[model samples]
Target chain A: MDLIQKSLLQQVAGLHDVPEGAYNIRVNGQLDSRNTTANIDIVTKEDKPGIDIIIKPGTKNESVHIPVLLSKSGLQDMVYNDFYIGEDCDVTIVAGCGIHNCGVDTSKHDGIHTFYIGKNAKVKYIERHYGEGDGNGENIMNPETIVHLEEGASMEMETTQIKGIDSTVRKTGGDLKDNASLEIREKIMTHGKQYAKTDFVVDLNGKGCSANVVSRSVARDQSRQEFFSTINGNNECKGHSECDAIIMDSASVSASPKLTANNIDANLIHEAAIGKIAGEQLVKLMTLGLTEAEAEEQIINGFLK
Target chain B: MDLIQKSLLQQVAGLHDVPEGAYNIRVNGQLDSRNTTANIDIVTKEDKPGIDIIIKPGTKNESVHIPVLLSKSGLQDMVYNDFYIGEDCDVTIVAGCGIHNCGVDTSKHDGIHTFYIGKNAKVKYIERHYGEGDGNGENIMNPETIVHLEEGASMEMETTQIKGIDSTVRKTGGDLKDNASLEIREKIMTHGKQYAKTDFVVDLNGKGCSANVVSRSVARDQSRQEFFSTINGNNECKGHSECDAIIMDSASVSASPKLTANNIDANLIHEAAIGKIAGEQLVKLMTLGLTEAEAEEQIINGFLK
Candidate 1:
């Protein structure tokens, strides 16, 4: 990998060098590096432009890193990645994408990821999207995530998009079986004239199943954002979804959360809030000798922390 | 007062039998009783169908009660009441209105109140609106409040509307001078087919002026609600506004909060949120053997508490 690609990897995946354990690095829509451990296997698909990561049963304390970097402007990249976890395994997956476009044409990436977890398996997924460039072109990313959890399985996913993405549409869907759980945390910030749209749908299909999805975002300048989430409780299950946003300057935000309960014991709820930074918060910070702009920056940093 | 009139008074205000420093009771469309103290005076207006309440300067530890009751159906009553608060005084004003409609026609009340607070004075105002009847008639209320605060003055207002009102339009406006402050807390609940609308505009017109406005509401059973609040920081001042609501069972709520900062030192913010109760709250209560309905009711009660 070149210096720019390595820098992009550091920015998106926190990888300063070659990562440990199973890892796959893709740069400019081509495979740059690949490695596999004793408990994990990474294989390229024959017909598709992606890889399949398979983890052995009972694997513990293992990790996988798949980071993609696009340093070539005007490149349109698409990839399909799938993960399969064996029963009673616990693992962590880090997947991120970064784009450095310094040309006159737009750069775009579309990533489709699907996860299948066995019974009693546990997984934690972290994904970050970032863009940096001095060119007039735009950086755009669209990500789609699908998950299926068996009985006694659990998955926690965290996704963040904080800077330089000119446009994005993110979609996530999950289905949980008996005693299974799914949790998702999403954080996004849009500045300039950027636009962001997020959609999430989770279904609790069996008794004792639960799902929780929460999103926090900030929109500044003339940026616009829309968040839509729906939770369906089809049995004796619990589901909740929440969206919170901070609006600044001429920014606009709209949130719609819907909940459905199809059974007597099913319970579902949803909440959404959109607003600006509280005056009292700013005043308290300003009283501590910080300028208004400094106070605002501190508040936003803490909020997105 | 008759038994029904007394009961209405008790419901709107905390009055069993009026015994206070100064009080005025209006039943239906006429005056029921009036009393005054050495420092506080309540006089019937000669040009209108309301009263003027005047408090002497330097007065302390005084209270006033002006409660209005409407028990006659098909009656549309409109009155203009004004308050003149003297400088260096500390006072509490209890004002409320109750309507009991037991006929086939609509009962409506329009109360227009204007307050002039002098310099260095402090005031607390509480107002509650309630309606109860078994007939097919609808109950409607339109309340308008205008406030002007002099230098170094402060006012805190609490208003509530919980039950039985079929429709309402509440409007409040305030202007704050140098070193003046205003705080408002509004709570409302709408059930059945009831409709409620609230509008608030506050202007911080001088140096060191500030304003804070907050509203909490619950909409249930097809009820509709709209909340609009605007805070203008025209000088070296601070302003904030917020609207929070819960929507349930086909209920719809829309909130629009705006902030304007005209001066370099002006700080302004606004926030709004609308959603449903949390499912975990219900599950927690249900684990204690409470029914879902009971848990829901308890959550709503505590939220509006």
Candidate 2:
């Protein structure tokens, strides 16, 4: 069953026509299964199902963003197993999950998505996870993304988790070659009593390579969140990792980052910290006439920004 | 002239007790040149002369602290290079400098200190840089410390930089092997216009290794601070690095931590952030009858706590 799913996902992901420039995507209104692209293939049955496509741009001009949205019921409820972005293409993929089907209750739901970027490809991927109102059941999402950058390739990835229905676990891995660089910024904000875990790993296999990982989390009430990151520098590779967390009220947050360097000349650094907001900042905002909640929100937004 | 200074510096470093778990130190508090370490050999006479020595443990396990006063006048009102700690054992070294000698008119004065740690040894190094009154100087302190950790070694390093200085730069490096570990923590608070930079690099070459680095900085006024850290992982090494900075008003801060993993099985992570205090904290403190400065100070202290 797993083999069939993997093959199906690969087939769907191999259909993209990723161009060499910027790609812009937008998913504004509701989209039905009948509106599927001719070049994209989607399946809804068992084993590797859902929508899959290769994003190949036809233009060679400025950068663009290729947007993807789950608007309608068929697209929203389908099981998306695998997703991949091809090599040597500078592209931006924006994906957002909207809450249109409001009345639903279940215990467990799994949505797995996989991404693979080719060597020397500069890709900017932004994922926005949000749900409106309060839905029942454990809505589980497992997004596994793997990126491989050849020599001189660079990638800037951003993941924002805001207001969710159930729980989320995101895992990401990347490989960088000589002079390659990878930068990942993540911001997670929640006030619900749920669990969220985001784990990231990057390896700099070549000489003079670099990596930057930064995460900011704000939790309120009984919410719990964990962030784990690891960066490895092998044989003259230079790698760096940074992790930070903020807890509010009864929220529980944990962040752990590890860095390892094997070569005598290799340099590595890792940092992790957990704390609350400062007092002086709150006073400054209160003096400006804003209420307590308003001030906290402003500071949270500014820190993430 | 430069050659002489380099040799003198090298000689002093060599006085570190070879490769034992003992600390050998020699000091001359007076400038008369008559009171000096008997084993001390001077290799240079020019600016920053090179010195060498071999120190044997004086059969005492007492807590040792050496004060290197940079404000002292030499043949021509020059600052003296203070040397206090020696090598080959587990020791706690405390080095501090005050801002009484340098007048307020000058804007640039460089003070540099060199330190070397041997294999299979543990060292707890505490550096406190503080000033009194308002007659501050553009003091530039560059303390270069090099540590070589053989099988089963560790280090706990702490630094506090506060008041009466225009700028500070600190660079620390360590080479670890055979389950060696290094832990460093720095707390920095600044008032007035100043610039400070803290940099640390730890390279893991052994099969089982670990590293932890943490830094906290509070900047007021138009002061600026930068922190750069790198942790390298090799041969199944585990490492971690973390930095947190709090800003007020126009205070600016920049922190960048890099973690590189070269081994496929090595684990590493890093975290960093720069931001101002929050507002809700202040409102709560105001309700408790604390003034703005008092509340802010409470917040700053709370962050360090």
Candidate 3:
């Protein structure tokens, strides 16, 4: 891989060099490098432009990295990835995409990922999106994620969009069976004339199931953001969703969270808040010898951290 | 004052007995006790059912307490109080109302407070509302506050509604002149089928003027709450408004904050957020041996603190 691809990998997936264990690196719409371990298998899809990841039963302490980079301008990339986890397995999956467009044409990427987990399995998934360049073109990304958790299965997802993406539409959905659980944390930041929209829905379908979803974002300059979340409790379960955002300059933000409980014992709640930095907070930081701009930057960094 | 009135005073204004300095206590729609100091004068209004409080110029470190209580159900009371603060004075004002109705009819109180602060003066105002009873009667309160801050003047206002009020509507407005500033903090909590609404508007009409308004609230059971705030920066000034709320059970909350910056140097922002207790927060507390309910209580207490 080139230095630009290596830097993109570092920024999105925290890869310092050629990683150990199972890994796949894609650059400019083609696979650049691939590796597989004893407990993990990575196979390229024969009919489409993606890969299939299979984890053996009882697999533990293993991880797989699938990071993609687009260095060519005017490139439109679409990929489909599927993950199948065996029962009693515990593993981690890291997937992300980065775009560097320095031309007059727009560059776009759409990713669709689906996860099927067996009973009593546990998986931790992390995905990050980033774009950077000094160009007149735009960077756009649309990612859709679907999850199905079997009985006693659990999943934790952390997704982030760092910077430079001009537009994005992120959609995520999950279904939890008996004794299953799902947790998701999302973070995003938009600046300039950029726009971002996110939609999340979760269904608790069996007894003792639960789901928690939280999103934190910041919008600056003329950027705009909209967040929508829904939680449906179809059994004796628990669900919660929340969205928190900060607006600066002429930016705008809107949040709507809905909850539906079909059972008397199903507990569901949602909360959303959009606002600017607090005067007291800024004053307190300025009293510690920081300027107004510095204090604002510190506050935003801390909030998005 | 009687025992019931004294208890109500304690709950609303933290007055265990006759307060020091100037004070006026009203119970059952009549004056129960009155006192005045050399620097502060309290006189009953001849044209209305309220009092006029006048503070002398340079009246340093002086304070006044005006508390009202209603013990009889089926009563509707309205009062208008005006305050005149002389130039260069620094004072504190404590005002609150409490209702303890144990009958079959609703008890209500409507208070209108207007303040005319002189040039270069400073003031700190605190107000609290509370209601309690075991009967079928409802407690209702509607309080309105208007302030005119002169050049170089400043004021900080803190208002709170503790509990048991079945319905309430609170409105506050402020106007700031050159080099003047205003700050307001409000807190409210509603349970059962209670309803609460709050509206705030502040105009920064002069150079170097600023205003900040913030509200925190919690809704439980089937309660509902609505918060609306508008900040108009008409000159080279700064303004901000925010609302934060918690929703539980079948409760609902909505917040809308608007900002208008007419001048190029006018800086304005607003923020709002509503949700229930976080799952991770509860789990962290449960790890310390507390139950889920106890953890939620502790979190709510800390958030409101």
Candidate 4:
């Protein structure tokens, strides 16, 4: 029984420590620490024709707390090479972080994440940043992210930036590849004095590539948030981007989504806006006796849902 | 000449005091006053047909601010009936207000405003809102506006929401009319902790009516902002709405633009987004030796140009 339990634990901790014909990164973590976890990959030390990468957070040496604001060292290193998904091969990567702290004082943090997805391989990554500290003193956090996508590959990435010490984030990422597709989505909500900034850039280098970006923000109290998304269609590629931000109470949100078409043949479409819960809809619900807050809640719930 | 200037001022002021067949509104104080403005024009007083109204703050009382945020108000009361424009009749209304003492710190604001257009009339209205007094407290505001259109009437509205005492705001509006058209444009910029929200909605109710809405937002510092818009089609109406918001430093923005089709025969389109000045575009200018900020400023100047 003990051997069996140990073997299961090892498998969960090292899900990505094997090489498959089709590139795939399967990450499963043990609930040992709140801030840090182990990374296992069955990558051969020998350099070859495969993709080369140098993760910024690297393997942890003790539970490291992401700072409220990113530091110079945090984002200094660039990944060695763009990850290549061999032609006709499928690749999927799931990478995420667990952030939790318990205390009364304010907290600030910054983190830098980088990614390079190579040609012909499809990669899907999920990123989650979550903290459990109660809203207290003014806290600021800035996190930066960058991504590069190569030709004939596809990527679907989603990020969830949830409650935490008041923080701000500046994230930058984009893709480049022929016939490649990238889908990016972010869900953010904050309270206290948290302020956040995020930026995304998509570059289509190969023909037939596509990009889709979406963002949703929810804020309350004195908190502030902002989102910037730029989708560039180069070399006759197609791109579509959408962003939505919702504000609650005294909280504020600002978002901009841009689509730049460098090629006349490029098919690009973009849409973005900021708004509160609809008044007419609220009235319709209120006529049925639902309170104002309840109506607002219903709208938000619908959006998030 | 002095007498002429005073007479002109009096005439403009008088146009606001009493609603007229010509589109007109005058305010001695802030139109966003929570108490009075919240319920302004909620129910069209039958006695005052052809005159649309809105509730706003009274400069006569220093105690009231942002009166348009009423806790209990009916949907119909928040709207004004058709303010007609006689066929080929040329008319203009000058509306301006000085507002101070808002509730939210580090916010942007757009006063609640709504409009109604009737058949065969041409109407023009210009509105400006500014902060007065010491500007000590942060002022946050949300203004709601809707426009109703009838056959063959045309309307144009211009607004500018500038500098504040750390205010935040959400402004939302739209139009509905057949053969009637509406044009709206606004410019906004903010520093300090000011955060702002602005939105435009257009619903073409009658055949051949058209609508256009355009706006821009600029923000700096730890502030935040957002813009949401929808250009909806109905009953063979045609409309378009466009918006852009720019962010600098730690500032942030969120925008969502939606194009909805209510009638298969109607044509409607809209675009919205928020983004930083492009880096590569700036770098290209910098390669020619322009400073980073100067390059960016030049790009912005070109965009505005």
Residue-wise lDDT of candidate 3 within A1-305, one digit each (tens)? Answer: 88888898898899888787899998989999999999899999999999999999899889999998998988999999999999999999999999998888899999999999999999999999999988599999999999999999999999999798999999999999999999999999999999899989898898999999989988888887877777777777888777777777877666655565544456665555556787899999999999999999999999989
Candidate 4 local distance difference test against the native: 0.52
What stretches of model 1 exceed 4 Å from their correct place? A15-68, A74-91, A104-121, A135-153, A162-305, B16-66, B74-91, B104-121, B135-151, B162-180, B184-305
Ranking by DockQ: 4, 2, 1, 3
Residue-level lDDT of model 2, residues B12-109, one tens digit each, is 23222221232222221222222223423222225643232223333123333333333422211223333333434566555554433345443332
Put down candidate 2 lDDT per residue, A1-305, tens digits, no spaces: 13322222222222133323333222322122222233222333345444453544321122332223332222234345344444566755554443322344432323445555555667676766654433543344455567677776777878776665357788889888888888888888767687788888887788777888888877777787777777665645656666666567666665656544334334555556555666789889999999998988898889777
Task: Give the Cα lDDT of each candidate.
Answer: 0.87, 0.57, 0.87, 0.52
Q: For each candidate, what TM-score against the reference?
A: 0.60, 0.48, 0.56, 0.44
* Angstrom error at residue B128, model 1: 1.1
Q: Worst ten-residue run, lDDT, model 4 chain A?
A: A63-72
Q: What overall lDDT, based on C-alpha atoms, would model 1 receive against the true structure?
A: 0.87
Model 1, residue B116: C-alpha shift (Å): 6.5
Q: Chain B, model 2, TM-score against the native?
A: 0.75
DockQ-based CAPRI category assigned to the predicted complex of candidate 1: incorrect
Q: lDDT per residue, candidate 1, A1-305, as tens digits?
A: 88998899998899899899999999999999999999999999999899999999999989999999999999999999999999999999999999999998899999999999999999999999999998588999999999999999999999999999999999999999999999999999999999999989888897899998988988888888877776766777877777777777777666656555445456555555556788999999999999999999999999888
Docking class for candidate 4: incorrect
- Give a tens-digit lDDT track for model 1, residues B209-240: 99999889888888888777777767778777
